[model samples]
Target chain A: MKSRDLFKKEHSDEQSYVVIHPLDDQPEQKKDLSNFEPMKMTFTVRLSLIILRVYLISMILLLAYHFLNLTGIIKL
Target chain B: MEEKSNKIPDRVDQPSTVIRTRYRWMQKIMLFLVVFGPGLIVMEADNDAGAVSTYTQAGAQYGLHMLWVLLLLLPITYFSQEMVARLGIATGKGHATMIYRRFGKWWGRFSVFDLQLLNFLTLVTEFAGINLATSQMKLSPDITVPLVAVGTIIMVLTASYRRWESITVFLCLLDIAWIIYAIRLGFSFEKITPAAISFFPSGQGITSSYIFLVIAVVGTTIAPWQLFFQQSCVADKRLRFSDLGYARLDTMIGAIFTIIVAGCMMIVGYMAVHSAIGYVYKNPAQMATSLGAYFGTIVKSGLLLLICNASILGITAVSLSSAWAYAEVMNWPTGLELKPKQAIGFYLIYILGVLAAAGLVLIPKAPLQLIIMTVQVLAGIMLPSSMIFLQLLLNDRELLGNEFVNRPWNNWINWTIIIGLFALSIILAVQVVLPQLFSS
Candidate 1:
């Protein structure tokens, strides 16, 4: 039987099936889920730090640039 | 092929007698109502505080020279957004989620970095907008800022998709204020010449300052955060192929509204400020005040109140979008559907973002002007890269399948925007750097 037909029959039988072309008949590999882990770090603290740092740097650079421009230290 | 006669009389042949339809009329009705969330909300969010401010600035500075850009962006915006809609529908995934899954951790982390940074900066701008708006009303920021923040939290958290979308659409309609304001400008209808036609640099002659502002207008319009937010909204709303028509319609309406508002703002600036006087104010409030003084009190009050309303509405929408993008990237429960407990991290992060922004405003020594300008520059720098990534992702056949993919014409326009933005950015940089070098 053709692999496509065989796979269809297996699917109808409530079984997982993998089809490989005759030219490249490698066996299908399944991913192992046992070692999977959730992300570490408290979401609140990390997110807060990220937001704080972004705001601070942006504000500093912006003000410095503006001051320089306004004081005629920088043109345009 | 030979066994067709012995196939136990196929289901089609046996089903001719006594047909009974299993109807799902009510379910279909409910689904139709629910699909309204993403399209309307995303569109309204695009009109947020920064956009209003940018439009106002563009109008004030260039008069109507940049009006063409707005008209041009309409189709571009619709096409780009439609691609995102398709991505969401085909994959049942958010933009960030797809990037993580397909490209693995490196690209995913890079996207996260870009999103978080941009979201934070944009959030600060939103807060500043709210502050600017409220200050015009003579309302204290302490009360106005907190009241607006709390109100947004309550609205986004408490409302279901149907209720939330209806309210957002209602707020979206407030954008009509621009139309009303623009009508007041009274540009010549017969001749219909664009107000400011000169391509030469305004004020400091071909300087970086003018170039940066020009780039800022474009950058702020088609932002990176918008891509993540819109795609996630599309996926979360669970749009399907059948709904593509409605989705496209929604996007077209939004793009048109965005451009119109932009055009009006420029006209108002041209008529009220640029024509009457040559000086440019630091923000929208001053411009509105200038309008009131030159035109009348009615125009002033109308512009002021509209600015405030636009600011509050925009901040709320963009903040929620930022939160949604972050949550989707982290693979956490994200959306207005989730309760505080269900998405504590998501909600908390958003609240922290608001508070930090507010805190910046409260600081005695903070440079608000610089913060706003830098945000604009950063937004400009990030836009081209995001467009490139979006174009690549949309064209990937494995992701989009045969249903939808970029055509050559689409590629032409997308590349045009990319090249245009790059040239604008370079011009802005040179404009800024060259003047300083020569002057020194």
Candidate 2:
């Protein structure tokens, strides 16, 4: 009876170890990276982008005029 | 591609077995390859058309007097960029995001605004160089400008970040010809080598002109966009704290390459053939004209190719920096990993930048030389502001943890650089705007 109980206890410990680490010998698993980035653009973000675009276009035009003036195409 | 596996171990326990160790070795090699682009690309792109003109002019007009400046910049560049690499790995975020989160939205917005404006203006110079080179080759602006614009857009749009990196790296390698050109010129090292070692200043007039050139070299060598671009690139590559050593190695290699290219450029120009004009290095094309008179059309062809390559490299990196900063600030999906259709706002900003810059180059009879010179000078004026922010962020313990704060020695070097750059900028300003005070 003593020998049987010792064997049972060792087996139970092994089982618990396996439970804790299911793939201790496994080499690889494909990572699930989906849903890491949100799909929807928030309203505030959309608004900021629009404002940025307007500012960008205005600057481009202003830059063009400045270049032309420097080159003598337009005497600013 | 950025590694998805770096964040996870293959086996939870006993992951370091012989076979797994081999696998991990391969993984480390791949990670290094992915992290390699931004540093080298940013460094080489610094050797852009404006930079070419400035360095070549320095050599031809000033001789090896400025060679010491290039040599000194080697370490200065390395330490400044090293902090960027550390920041990115520690935070896994772009410079813009960190600045915004840590320094308040107002400061963040100011930095971004400054970056975009300077980037846009700088892009003008790159396209201007492209226009000049292609025009000299008998390729009209109408054909060359649009084609380059389309080609740049397509290159960035169709490929992943890895692919774009490969293409730019290949283009940057073409600069090796400058070294060969220097060798062929048979640089009189017996004459200039001593001066180069002695940190001689080449004694150009101590007027605004000389100070302006000094500032231009510093500005173009350590451009502001480089800081942002490298940080974003580090985050995009998914670097972790463990990769800091390799990242610093990558940056060191870049700094070495940057100085070598600049050195070769100066050598090629120092020996350029010129008359009573006294080694005139007014512009890259003008320098080419003088060199061609002595060395034949081959000099022109070589100069044009180098300039064009630098311009294309600049356009891609600068526009990407803009797109990255804008997207990060607005909380949009970012990364070349995403499909264009998915990252519409991000990609749109990039395309807009390229097209707008190219379009400005199409302006009738633009003052190309004036524009390039002005842009580089303006860049020098604006660089100290960016460095201040970088210095602040790198020293922030809350952000980087205790292991990575600037050591006392590092702080000393940094403060010396900051003080030196600020002092020069101030002196240049006073000389330019209030010359009478200096004259007195």
Candidate 3:
């Protein structure tokens, strides 16, 4: 038995929503990132995102510094 | 493969009709059972191979002194995961898709790439753990690693979502054996009470070694993959807004049980400390062997089997998260319900992840130490950032709406957790990069 047929037999129920993409030419629900609207960057949201960016950069820099320090590339 | 329903079941107004009856309590219980898997599996699977070693080492070195830390972490774990459950139930989308859709391609791509790299590295460590555990039983990695790898793939490929979840949940319950084993090792409530109450190890103060181990415990408990795994799992399970309370309860129960099992593992480690040959710090496999020398074969075999089980759980959950996130971002078909023929890209990602990790572990001169160190640093970096994304997503009023958007108090608590996790991640990074810094 082919897996496509098996899938058809198995999902021949009210519970076939599990197939986000179909084997047949049924309608595509577009369960990907297509349907949702992108987040509207309000003032507070932009500030929060900036803070997150700063935090990530600072942490990554600190890690790099430590790595270089451990490798004897930089002192102090 | 025709989909009768266009979306994963998002029926928010269910079970209300089912509960308008004399058997409301029974109906509620049944509803709870339906919403149970994502939370419990994520939590138990969080206690992966790395966690087992960390807890056991804490026990061996400090006895029950660290029980308070685990206790402190219970609420933190519950709140963090509860928000994830809500987002998953509300959005009906995976975390990666939400990030990509909302945060734009740059940040989205960054998250997806980091998650794939970190999850794959972590999976390798899990397979290494399996090899180490089986070595205790004189089982060769050549045979066991590939066998378990194939088993994990088949487990996912051959089952429906519900069946896969049921099997995983049953495997999660087997950790109860650790609790029983802890009891058999002679842990009494009276014996652990004082240690549980104490905040720090008696007579050792706050040494760098102790601090490092403490940070390690924290890092192990809450990981980035967990954020991805649970949100995707909740979506995969198709939980609805009506099931939010039950899902929260499920997450809470999972958090409590995972911590208890971790505490039991710590007890096992503490008992190993008193063995005929006193506890010398080493890997869990050695600890099991040493304990077996005194307690007999059951101690060794039970610990090894449990470690192997932990590895299997870790591999499944971690690999699935990677697959789901990657496929979601690529707009490929994704779900356990889909046959291999139906969702080739998704299954390929999952299978390749398992096989690659397992194969790496089998190679004689694999650079496992470097891989482990990189995993640590990447995980340390990834965990806090993932939480930040989750926090922002949970707050998106447009996405979750007023009904599901986070309350102000949730923001406060989650921000606090993110900060605390940031500090732990930094400490972990330092420990990895400058090991000498923690030697004193």
Candidate 4:
């Protein structure tokens, strides 16, 4: 069978799929997996990323808010 | 049967295996070549017109005391970009789409908004550079600015990914003229060695002006648009996990080449500072002015060429990032594969970005200097949040298989970089606001 057909048959998901030609030199072990689903994160880890995101966004917003106030666009 | 065997050539022997192996190697090489442009282009594009100014300002204003900063950032640049490659290859999604999927709409929209705002402002700085360059050669902004905008529009509308990338890569290669011109103006390795190794700010570097310049340098090297641009480019190019190592190699080579070019830019200004005709610089253009005076018009043309190409390159990348990020967030069809007619929203966003920036640059007395510096500061403010998303996504084992995930030690190093950049951004914001709050 053609390698492209083999690729389609072995892994058909739209995420990611490697088209490993028959004669390529990559190792038999340690395949670079593609088409991966997001691994579920623990609550604590998820909260940390969320917190960092909120804090940084707030900082930028505060800066913007200050500019608006200085320009008398709104009184807060 | 004899005739068929003769035509087959490998019918009697074990040559089929060897032929297939060689053919396979050739195929792999070809694939690598085709996938090579995005990483290198994105990284080199970081050293765009704004970067040329920032690095030149850093060297001219503070000399080699800041050389070590470039050395320090080499790894940070590599680690940061490698995450984008990993995400693009594994999840097969653009950064915006991935953020929307993995996080939520709020964070995703925020990213898109931040990118387009900062990206448009950055494009203005790029056209300003083009205008400055072209005018040095007696070409008016009325002529050059609209010409560049039209050219940029045509480039994105090419609709063929490979053709567009080949054009970008060719421009990226021409950027090396900055270093070559520096050599012609009298760059000596012996003069560079001692200063290159200096590890901290010295002389006039302890002032607020120096501190602000340092942050600008960092911002120039590790801007937020890169994260979005590379991820989208990878998705558009259809890069799979097998291309991961090759992409990282391409990223590394690009980082090294750009840093070397940045270093040469610093040398160009530093030579003038130490020359018998030494004087303080009033603007980034002075680096060219001094070199032009000493070495003649060739130096000016060389500098102008680098500036114009760098600006044009930045326009392509920055505009595409805006288009791709916005389209992905809106769930609209977006890719270079789609004809301009097929992907109207995508092409529209790209065209509007260039046109708006071109219009802003044409405004008389528009304070281009402040606009440029403000965008850098704004990008610095926005970087940590984007990076937070990128890091979490990178470590998510499901998103990238365990084999491709960041290890524990990698997290430690990554966190350190995040904190350092976060701190620099705050300092930069303060300096821009107060100007002399901490200056000596």
Docking level of model 1: incorrect
- Could you arrange the candidates by DockQ from highest to lowest? 3, 4, 2, 1
lDDT of 2 at B275: 30
Residue B137 in candidate 3, Cα distance off native in Å: 0.6
Which candidate comes out best when scored by TM-score?
3
TM-scores for chain A over all candidates: 0.40, 0.46, 0.54, 0.42
Scored by DockQ, the top model is 3
List, residue by residue over B328-358, the lDDT tens digit for candidate 4: 8887899997899899999999999999999
**Ordering by TM-score:** 3, 4, 2, 1
Model 3 scores what on Cα lDDT? 0.82
Candidate 3, which CAPRI tier?
incorrect
Best by lDDT: 3
Candidate 2 residue spans exceeding 4 A from truth:
A1-76, B1-31, B195-208, B274-279, B365-381, B429-440
Off by over 4 Å in 3: A1-37, A66-72, B1-22, B195-197
Per-prediction DockQ, in order? 0.03, 0.05, 0.13, 0.11
Model 3 residue A6 lDDT score: 20
Q: Compared with the true structure, what per-residue lDDT tens digits does model 2 show for residues B1-440? A: 12234333333334242121223355455445545766788788788877887888777766666777888899989988888888777776788887777656766897798888888888888888888888777788888888989999998887477678788888888888888888767765576566554444545336645556666677668888888888888777655555577788889988999899998887777777333245555677777766666677897788788888888988988898899998988889888767899899889999999999899889987776666545644454556656666776676654455777788798889878866776665555444433455552
Residue lDDT tens for model 1, B1-440: 10112222123223331122223453333334445556555655766677777777777766666776677677767777777877766665677776666545765776777667767777667777777767776788778777777766676677354456667777777778878777776665442453345554245365545556566666666777777767777665545554566566767767777777777776777666654566575677777877777778887778877776676666666666667767877778876566788888778777777767767766666787766655665565555556656676666654455566678888888778766765665444334334454342
Deviation in angstroms for B297 in model 3? 1.2
User: How many residue pairs clash (N, CA or C atoms closer than 3 angstroms) in each of the candidate models, in the order given?
Assistant: 5, 0, 0, 2
Error of 3 at A21 (Å): 21
